[model samples]
Target chain A: MILKSLIFINGFALFIGFLILFLDKVISRYGTVTITLNSEKEFKAEGGKSLLRVLFENKYFIPSACGGKGTCGYCKLVVSEGGGEALPTESLVLTPKEIRQGYRMSCQLKVRSDMAIYIPPEYLEIKEYTGEIVSTELVTSDIREIKIKLVEPESISFKPGQYVQIRFDVDGDFDYRAYSVASHPDTQGEIEINVKLIPEGLGSTYLHALRPGDTVYFSGPYGDFFLNTDSKRKIVCCAGGVGLAPLKAIARYWLTHASNREIEFYFGSRTTKDLYDHSMFEEMAGKSPNFKYFPALSDEDPEWDGERGFIHTIIDRHLEGGYKAEAYLCGPPIMIDAVTDVLLSKGVPQERILYDKF
Target chain B: MNLALILFASIITSNIALTYFLGMCPFVSISKNIRVASGMGIAVTIVMTVTASANWLILNKVLIPMGLQYLQFLVFIITIATLVQIIEIFLDRFSPALYHAFGIFLPLITVNCAILGVSLFAMLRVYTFWQTVAFAFGSGIGWFLAIIAIGGLRKKLMFADPPENFGAAGITAILAGIMALAFIGFTGIASL
Candidate 1:
């Protein structure tokens, strides 16, 4: 008789649980605004939901390095109207120039009423991919080479120099970090990413913990760092540490198809131990007569006999006759700034240099 | 024992934000301006009241009987999160003006420790239903009052010359410490 009563009470409690959850859903369903994005797309979003969340749910991608935390200041969009007051969160991230141009942080702006927003033309074409980790290898003591087999899309079409945002589920929250796609665009079903373990970074921490056969959430073919096909100028590629990600991607593309340009890649490192995939670059140099690889070490052992000095010094010595060539630099802010000064002094136009600094 | 004493004690002696240091993030960030701070203060007050009452019902009626008392923290957090989401939706639909005023701060209230702190305190004290409601409402007003007073002081300080090292958070922290000390004077009043 006691067991029967206990069973009845448990059943009643379960019913109450369902009731509460159901009521919550019912209450949430009452209020919401319909948003029409870019004129062609339509989504029924919960009214007062942030524009970023709405767009994300509708498969419209906006670049947000901070994963809706409103910290990185990357998610910006042009809203024609219907976005309420400029939020404090958005104000912290926007510049006076951006404020005048109607650029608002999409994550901070909520849709109180029906709204229209114009996303960048490039963001519309970005795709999300599900890929399986096929291999994981250590590139440096702290950096890892993660190669994924594209599961759903079968293949991705992207410029050789672009980057993708890798998303990881950490502590019940989704965190995203961007990494340059290192594999050639021509490679089907396989995507390669070189990640340096950021000391306490959410994505890097998870990437460091991951092993082969893990499924990871990644989206992209974003960023505009690809090589300019119109220029026949000599190319000076400067890379430091994991900045090798995009440089390697561009090099893979250049080796496979584009053979006419003169390319000299100057890779810088703190010590000889920092170098990875040296044989791969040497193989590429052997295959392409126009390509040359210069691995410069800032501190070389006594037994080492390669170029020793800062990368800027090496470029200064070898890049004679001023900058008649386009420059692509990817490194720490200090290195990028120092190299920019050197390259500009050598006559490389500021507009011709493309770079991304963390 | 009565509403007036409860109000007085809550607003002065035991402010959730100033006394317990709950909801300090929004207190510091939103307190830069008086107008916005007042809006956020009011929003927090309303949400705290509603969340406390709802959580009391769930705790007394559901969890206690099922021997699920250990789930209090998790249940309270999820309840607050879901309640904030629901309230945000309702506010956007019914009153766009108020929604615009409180829109930015409403979502952040989910993580605001004051709301959770009040709910947990109410449960810990095991207040009667009516007492729970009164305590919740009183605590909300206390938080509102503290933030508004600090906001006004900050606005005034903006024009005054502060010491070289006492700018921004330095001055705010000193002022907060002084205010907390002053609030101790109210402790002599009849306890709630």
Candidate 2:
């Protein structure tokens, strides 16, 4: 009798599953959508899906930090016609000026019928990547250097100082965070990034748990923070902690193709223990006499050596006679602010300063 | 005592938004504009009326006869979700203009607590079919009235010099509190 009851329950479960699947297929059949992206490109996508998902599926990549949740307000596109009314979620993020110009959150707008959309020119070049983690090493207690082997696309051709968005799966949450690419532009089949763990950060937590050989989803070669080729001024690169990621890329670029211009790298840390990979910088300095590595320690112990004091103060003391150097600053907000003020006061042009802050 | 009294009490004396606070998500979100609020209000009213009547029939005919009364909440939520999906498709096919107006809000309505709240209350009170219909319609209208009133007040308040701390949700909550107090005035109305 118990076996018979178990059989009955299993049969009932199967029936319900089939019923739900049949109804889903039936409901999906009623809606048809044709999406014309950027007017020049056209594709037929599943109706009732968000425009962002459809566009992403069609390889028209638009940057979305919230993964189509509509909370990030990053995936904005101009819908010329045939899209339905702007949703409440879209309205919450869109400014009055943006609404007037036909900008809508692509994730919130569903393609009910044939619609025309306009994507930005810059976003047209964005591409997705699948990679495997080649190495994960703790640079500091809170900072990690992750090296990934690019499986598809073989190699990514990016500027020296561009960043990539890394995605990880954790507890059913598909979260992505942007990290500066530390690997040199010439390096093929492999990429590296330095990630600083923010307390309770979803991406950092997942990344901390990740081991070598773990497959990861990442996209792009985004951002334009490279050295300006047009300018021949001296370059001063300043970084704190894991802000060394992008600056490392810039340093690698400079090392490969030696320029007549002078470059000085100022790396700051709380103590000697917080520092990592000092030999790499020292080797670069050895190769090029024009290149200088200044590792500044904020606090010193009894056996202390080299430069000591705040990085900005050290920079102020060393920088002589109103030099025309383009300053690259990356660090915590407080550090970046202090460095920029000092650099600006020392006669570095405002337009020549390139920086990124979290 | 009767259907009329129940309708009156549901619509005025015990409004879902002002009293029970069931559908506050869409109430606050879509209530930014009067036109959109009215459109959502009408759509919700239709869904409530139809779903309430259908659920009453299902409860009396299917669940009650099978001794499955304990499964009412789960059954009601699933029924409401499926019914909303079906109605959304039908609206898109037949009435394109109405669908265009309420299509985005339809998905939001599926998870709205007010619809389930009304169904549960009707079941709890042992309301008959006609009384269920009346209560559902009255409650929908009550929600509509409350949201539209708040929407108008918010529109006017946009230009007012609200306090720094009481700018968005703070002032809105104060207004809602005052409205709740005003709604209490209808408690003493003559019985239908």
DockQ top scorer:
2
- Give every collision pair in model 2: none
Interface RMSD of the predictions, in order shown?
A: 6.0, 4.7
Angstrom error of the Cα, residue A79, model 2: value is: 4.4
**Fnat by candidate, in order:** 0.05, 0.05
**Candidate 1 local lDDT, A139-238, one digit each (tens):** 7888899999999787888887788888777677565788888998888678899989889878888888888999988888877788886777888899
The DockQ of predicted model 2 stands at: 0.21
Per-model TM-score versus the true fold: 0.64, 0.69
State the lDDT of candidate 2 residue by residue for A77-186, as single tens digits.
Answer: 89989865666677889988888889999988866678999988888888888899999999888889999999887788788778888877667745567788888889
Task: Tell me the DockQ of each model, to 2 decimals.
Answer: 0.16, 0.21
Report lDDT per candidate.
Answer: 0.81, 0.81
